[model samples]
Target: MGSKLGYVYRVLKLGGSLITNKNVPFSFNEELVTNVVNVIKNFKVILVHGGGSFGHYEASLSKENTQTRTVIAMQELNLKILKIFNKENIPVFPLPGRYFTINQVLEILQNNLIPIIYGDILPNGNIISGDDITLTIAKHFHTEALFATDVEGIIINNTAVSLLKSLDDFREIRTSQFDVTGGIREKLRKIFQYKVNSLIFDGRNPTNIYYALSGKRIGTFVEAE
Candidate 1:
């Protein structure tokens, strides 16, 4: 489904917290992920995921020599996701962040398959956040992003902001202690930096995931102006 402009790909990110229990090390929310995958099987979306309890817990253990461990942990979680997709008969393939060039992803899409990439540790020990990967592909194709997170959306004053246009709107939002990749704040920063319109919705509610993918904004819409 490419055009003279580009492929009409829906760049979606499955937040680590949405699929894994962030508080428990290496805890994968299999049932929730299975429901999410069921909804995703209907669409050919470019999928990106966070480290969550997997790589994040390992990365928090040591600053040095954790690259291999982090990658392995993230892959372990990714493999679990792959298994779900496979069981549902969805065509998906994994592309490590290190090898996640635009062309490599497009090649998978060209074959009518979905490409799944995750937040990974770069060779230099830098953490490549999943939001970074999502923005990279979404910005390239000028596509809107769908972020299925644990929260309903960006909340302020106990209410979710329907439309967010500036960073000042949620400056007080706190980042997680276990999140090595700067958490939600970092995700918002990249969204604004790339100027990619995105919907940050709660994946806890299975209906929200379906609504988001169906183009119905069920969460906070970030429009970097």
Candidate 2:
């Protein structure tokens, strides 16, 4: 919601790896989403979630589904997420990223309802990444971004680097599974381009979100300073 001080918008992208069983086709981790949402429910957030097993697995030839089918599958998962937030008495306006523009989302947030979005197949049949969703919203609103993945943070030579000041600090990133968006490297590349600092943290720990949202020094930071 807007305040006289103006809304301090934040884009929180819930990684598919954290909220879904990547190994299991179409499987969603409802509990993990619930936990993460519970911790950040109070913030001025524009929530975007990954497709996890749902989008990736469905688009796989093994699943006998194409990108169109994947779109339907992801939307179904979106409904479930809305239900979970509803259970907690949280007001969320679920938006399908492809069809909805960021300004409409601003309208929802202005009305005091959180806007929930996700990675999905667009109407033109392109796979939308959760990172894409987060970046788009962040740029439109100039908000800080947070990517919540399953891992502790971005791992470099088997170590999770806590802060990144430039791309020269790292060389490569590992894609989890069925990821069509070019993985962690792409995410880092785009987020660093923002004028605001971005963060990557483990969503499995609810407290980490609490700490991060409260502006604590947690997770890996991609400093835009």
Going through the candidates in order, what is the number of backbone clashes in each? 0, 0
What's each prediction's TM-score?
A: 0.94, 0.89
Q: What is the per-residue lDDT of model 2 for residues 1-225, given as tens digits with 9 covering 90 to 100?
A: 133338786678888788887777778888877887788787878898888788877765555447678888788888888999999999998888676687778788878899898887765667777787787777776656888888887787788889888778676655556766767888887776655578889878999888777777677887864
Name the lDDT of candidate 2.
Answer: 0.78
Model 1 clash pairs are none
Candidate 1 CA-lDDT value: 0.85
Model 1 alpha-carbon miss at residue 29, Å: 0.4
Clashing pairs in 2: none
Candidate 2 residues lying further than 4 Å off, grouped into runs, are 1-5, 62-65, 169-174, 194-196
Alpha-carbon RMSD to native, per candidate: 1.9, 2.4
Using lDDT, give the best candidate's number. Answer: 1
